[model samples]
Target: MVERLTRAVLAAPRTVLVGALALLVLFGLYGGGVASHLLSGGFEDPHAESAQATKILEDEYQRGGIPVIFKIDAPNRDVTADPVVGRVGKQLVEDLKQYDFIQDPVLSIWTDPVAARNLISKDKSSTLVVVPLDGGEDAAPGHAEDLAERFGGERDGVRITPTGQGKVFADTNTQVSKDLFLAEAIAIPISFIALVIIFGGVIAALLPLAVGIFSIVGTLALLRVFALFADVSIFTMNLATAMGLALAIDYTLLIITRYREEVAGGLTREAAIHRAMATSGRTVTFSAITVGLSLSGLLLFPQYFLRSFAYAGLAVVVVALLGSLVITPALLKVLGDRIDALDLRKPVRRALGRPERGFVPTEQTWWYRFVQWVLRRAAPVMLITTVVLLILGAPFLSIKLGFPDDRILPTSHASRVAMNEIRDDYERKLGGEVTIVITGSTDAAVDDYAARLSKVADVDAVTSPDALFVDGRAAAPRKSEDRHGEYRILTVTSNTDPLQDSGKTLLANLREVAKPDADVKFTGTAAATEDTVASIYRHLPWVLLWVAVTTFILLFLFTGSVVLPLKALVLNLLSLSATFGAIVWIFQDGHFGALGTTATGFITATMPILMFCVAFGLSMDYEVFLLGRIREEWLKSGKTRADSDHAVAFGLANTGRVITAAALLMAIVFAAMMASQVSFMRMFGFGLTIAVLMDATLIRMLLVPAFMRLAGRANWWAPAPLRKLHDKIGLSES
Candidate 1:
């Protein structure tokens, strides 16, 4: 099949190249504006109670609870009765009222003084203005940015800065865009130089870049299509470009190197293309399938933020695979022999007074010697490697998971700074109110429910339509926004940090306080966090099962051996566990202060699951590359234990340089993400870089070879029925 495809491609290389160029242009034009269509918030499960309650609040109550909450500071400590403060505050509220998008009667010290007191800071120098915007959730961030541009900063006697969930989302999206550009600027040039050095020819190096560009642009266009039907996050852009470039380079390098080897072995150009496509091209197909299946595990989760990654990941894998199999082979056929033009390795060797080495004998290569040393003491190598990986992964045992917040941004960010001040000096933190809507309940029942909510530990106040309840007592008649439709609304405010354990516990206790059969719903930061975590836990098992089962079957089909698949799964998990542990230590436990962000004491819940899928697929990508060569060598040599060992050494000696170079190049691309200001991006960048390096060196170099050596002939063993099944349907070169 591969030979036929190669012939078809070789027969019409120009037509293939022209068609590819046209598609690239079309994809570029359509995908250029994809970032604008992506959503800023997708962290909530739409089926959860919080989401349902939020929809009710939006649709039934006509209330956009909070706009961009602004922190206003005055020169005088006493805000009330201060002439300048009152004038500036009232003028700002009036300015806000002019915009129809903002909800009427913006609260300030002067307008609705009763509610404004709750918003006043403890020091009396600062107060918050609550201006609710009518725009829906998708447009809230844009509205916040517009408000910030017009009404934020100094006005008359006070300084106002926008700070809330809306503002935070806007700032985060902006940062993500900046980080994506920066990561690319840093990664691409370095990658090209490394590729040139690794491929040792300018023409060969350019092929990877061609494939990378094709994959990224194509995926971006595909993501735009996805955004039409689903809520795709802006964060997907970062992963799309990163993975697209990495995978493009990976598949291209593997195929091109195999072509060069076949050419050097006295094969004709067409035969070389056919053979390379049959072996390395098959590897690319299996690699894409494994990576795509691993990413598909994310679909089980309800959050679009997580699901969006799956979309981007799958798009990149598919697009890169297509480019590698279709466009790359066509380009290789046209550039045969000339692919070695503009030779760089020979010049470097000449300058260094070293002789030109075309291809070193396999027995004398460094990888061969290294493999021999490892196989001689395989038991100790495997034992020591496993122990080291386990030790690195120990910190993950204590990991705490939670939703992201303003803290995910850098400390100097305005949103985070405002939040810090609010947490420190305000009696009631802004946007920390848990709103409950109860249907089919009488006013008396609601009053009692409000009193119960006010009695919970750490509860600051619970304001219902009737009165404000504080510590189970009716403090005063409160004219609030809680009265809407036939449903009774209760707003519960507390000082607990909503992204912390205390916040989640408070939400749980509130839910428990509600009657078992009552038609009650909760919506707030804490409620959303609780629901999202629960959703992850509920769907987590299915994701793991899908990844494990599909990956096992694919590997089994590829290797025609049950033992190799099991070993690959175990090694990949071990490598990923260590990566998670390192992430916990650095991002969660706050061990690395140099990353320029404070530890939140909890890792973002979606990160671990996302990382596991991405890293595991990448691990298998390398595994397929190594094992394909090993299996090829094994089939030709004797079927004895010594022959198996010889095959392992020969495969390693042949493919070790490509794998190492590919790993380094991939690591460089991800390492550039360490420059991101957002803590999660930095953690992702650092964690994946560590994972790739460890897998390439520790697991692939040490553990895999050691295990294969120890297993000897057993590594290729399979049951009679399964062997026959594999012979019929397996993906192999021979």
Candidate 2:
């Protein structure tokens, strides 16, 4: 099938090129605005209890949405005592009222003294003006930006800084865009230099980069299509571009290197393209399927953040694979003998001793010698590598998962700085206080419930219609009507970080104490974090099962061996454990301060799962690339133990250089994201870079050969029924 497709593409290279160009243009034009359509928040499970509570509050009370907070600083003056500051605050409130997007009756120091106690800074030098936006988070950023532009700096003896969910998200989106550009700017040139070194010719190097560019643009366009139907995360753009570029380089390197090898072996250009497509092209296809299947596991989670990556990853792999299989072969056919043109570094090739046409220089190559060394000491090498991986993975046992917050932004950012101030001075007053909606309840019942909640460990205070409870007592009697008048709203404050265990424990205690007849539901940042974590873990087993089972099946089809599939899965998981542990050590545990990122004390909840799927899929991608060659050699050499040994060495020698080059290219691209201002992106960059480097060198180069040597012919064994099934439907490059 691959041969037939390549022959047809080669037969009409210009036609195929034109079609590809047309699709590129169409998708680029249509999907160019994908960023505008992407969302900034997808941290909550939409159907979780917290989400349901939020919805009810938003619909009935008009109060549960994210608030736009303005930190107004009045130097050397108490905000309330200073007439100028008070006048400016009034004017700001009036200005906000003129905008339809701002909710009515904004809360500020001038509105109510009771609320003002919390809104005002402790030194009286600053105050907070909080207002809910009309369109929730999606509409808040624009309004916040407009408000900031209008009332940002030094207005009537006060400086206003916007620091809220809206401003934070807007800033994050802007930073991610800049980071994407920066990563591309750094990655592209470095990748080109590396490719030039690997291929030893400029023309040969440019082909992979061209495919990478095409794949990135095509995937972006595909993301635009997805954006039309669902809310994609802005973060997805980073994943799409990174994965697209990496996979393009990977698949192109595999195919083009094979084609060059076949051409150097004296095959006609047509036959060389056919043979390259039959072997490397088939490998690229299987690699794409395995990667696509692994990433599809992310879709099982409800968060759009994870789902968006799945969409982006699948698009990148498919588009890059198609580009490698179709366009690369077509371009190879057109280039023919000139594919090696623009050779600037001929001395290195001469030193390496270029082989004659129709011959591969395995005996003279370094990779062959390396594989020979590994084979001679396979058992010890395997033990050492496994031990190293396990030790590196040890830190993952202490990983603490939490939701991302303004801390994800650099501390130098205004929103982050302002939020830190808020967290330090007025944490008890901050809006993450847990809210409970009790339906079918009287005011007296709600008062009792609020009193009981206040007594829960870690609960700082609770507010209800009848009274305010503080330190487990009714500190003051209050009169207030439920805005909706249908359900009682009980607000509880905790002294613990809402995303951490203390706050989650307090929330659980609150739920346990609430009367079943109260018809109670909890909602807040802590509740949402709790629910999001639970939701992800609830679906995690299924996702892992799906990825494991499907990937096993895909590997079986590729290698026709159950043991190899299981072995590959184990090795990939081991490498991923190392990656996760590194993330925990560097980002969570704050061991690597040189990276210019502060530790958040917890990894983002979705990052581990997303990284596992991405890294595992990419591991499987390289697995397919290596195993395809080894499988071919095994079939050709008659599958004897001696032949199996020869096949492992020969296959490693033939493909090792390409695999290393591709891994280097991928690692460089991912590492470029470390330059990002966001801590999560840095963690992602560091984790993936480590994973690729380790997979390509230690696992693929040393461990794989060692394991195969130990397994011998057993590496190719399958049950008779399974063998018959594989014979009927399995993919073979031979």
**Per-residue lDDT of candidate 2, residues 328-422 (tens digit):** 98888778778789876666557779743345488678898989899999999999999999999999999888888888999999989999998
Candidate 1 at 252: error in angstroms? 0.3
Local distance difference test values of all predictions, in order: 0.87, 0.86
> What's the lDDT for residue 387 in model 1?
99
- lDDT score of model 1? 0.87
lDDT of 1 at 226: 98
lDDT of 1 by residue, 1-734 (tens): 65677778889998999999999999999998998889877878899988898888877776644467888887565777677877877787777877777765577767775677678888799988877777655778888889988888887767888988778888988998899889989989999999999988899899999999899899999999999998899989888888999999999999998988888898998788888998999888888889999999999898998999999999999999999999889999888779989989888999999998876678998899999999999999999999999999999999888888788889899888997888888877555679897877777889988988899988889988899999999999866667676777888988777887778788888887865235998888888888888888899999999999999899899889999999998999999999999998888888857367779899888888998899988998998899989999999987899999999999887889999999999999889888888888888889889999999999988999999998999999999999999999988855
Which pairs of residues collide in candidate 1?
Answer: none
Q: Model 2, 621: alpha-carbon shift in Å?
A: 0.4
